[model samples]
Target: MSHATRTRPARTSASARRTHTELLSVYLNDHLAGATAGTDRARYLARSCRGTDLGPTLEAIAGEIAKDRRSLTDLLRRLHIPARRYKVYAGWTAEKLGRLKANGRLVRRSPLSTVVELEMLRAGVTGKIACWEALRQLAESDERLDPAVLDDLLHRGHRQLHALEELHREQTAVTFHASGPQAPTPASRGTGAR
Candidate 1:
């Protein structure tokens, strides 16, 4: 048979293609869940920190996160992948549930609460960085992705992590090491004096 007339080597098997599609769907769904949760956390942090030293930074992060979420949606659309709405809903629900967690205080915002939240936000940003890196790796094989955009997102994620870490450090120090009111002595307590 002539070289041009010969049949090309077979591509991936139908079953293998289906498996790949399934795995890709699962991967995208998982990333969407995390992105949704990160969006929730960012908004919460921005609102909760309003009028405080961390407010502006949180607001900026929140805005960036919102944009990132939109970008993820766009990417899914570009790839013709339907997002799992259920997972998105669940992620938002989980974020709401997180807000109800009890701190040591009954009515006041706990310093520890901010500390833990900063850590969680930082971790989420870290995860975002990973997602961007993974997508970047696929850009060579997948024409739907843009490496430049992924690079920009990866840089933003790192910046977000740095800002969160700085805030976390400052808050941790203030919460744990700053001078504070000491407990009343026995004599003072007995006398009913603060």
Candidate 2:
């Protein structure tokens, strides 16, 4: 082979670049949908737990999750990716439907609700962490992605996960180890009922 031929750099076709961007658009939109659900769930959980021992931490987490969703939206705009409103609406609807699950209570909030919601929030945060890590990797090649922003997001996600794990452990212990079904106190009565 000629030296020039061997030394020449390979080129990617325009179609290949378009395909890559299209795949990335799909992936990010999916994450945005999940983030929408997560934000809604976090806000709902925080409101339910208001005035409880976990209230402040949950409120903080809800705010952070909302901010993260905004960041994801901004990223989508920067990449010229359109937000799929249908996916966002589906996510919102799914979270609302999730509330109808049987939590062993009909007219009141159960301790099991806290445990289950915390578990769900933790899982969502874990997924967010994974998305941030994927973006961090992509930032190495994609000029539109900022490594600094991705790193900040990753750090916040890990912190959120740690807080959630602690809450989940405490709630699980309190919910499962009780001697029997304790009646709600007057102060607790009707507080979290939705």
**Tens-place lDDT digits, model 2, residues 119-146:** 9999999999998998899899889999
User: Which ten contiguous residues of candidate 2 have the minimum total lDDT?
Assistant: 6-15
RMSD of 1: 6.7
Which pairs clash in the backbone of model 1? none
Model 1, C-alpha of 38: deviation from truth (Å): 1.2
Cα RMSD of all models vs. native, in order, equals 6.7, 8.7
Clashing pairs for model 2 are none
What lDDT would candidate 1 get against the real structure? 0.86
What candidate 1 gets wrong by more than 4 Å, as runs, is 1-12, 178-194
- TM-score against native, each model: 0.85, 0.85
Instruction: Please provide, for model 1 over 1-194, each residue's C-alpha lDDT reduced to its tens digit, 9 standing for 90 to 100.
Output: 67545433333466677787788788888889988998998898789889999899999999998999898888888778899999999888888898887668778888888898898889888988888898899888999999899899999989999999999999899888847678887877778546
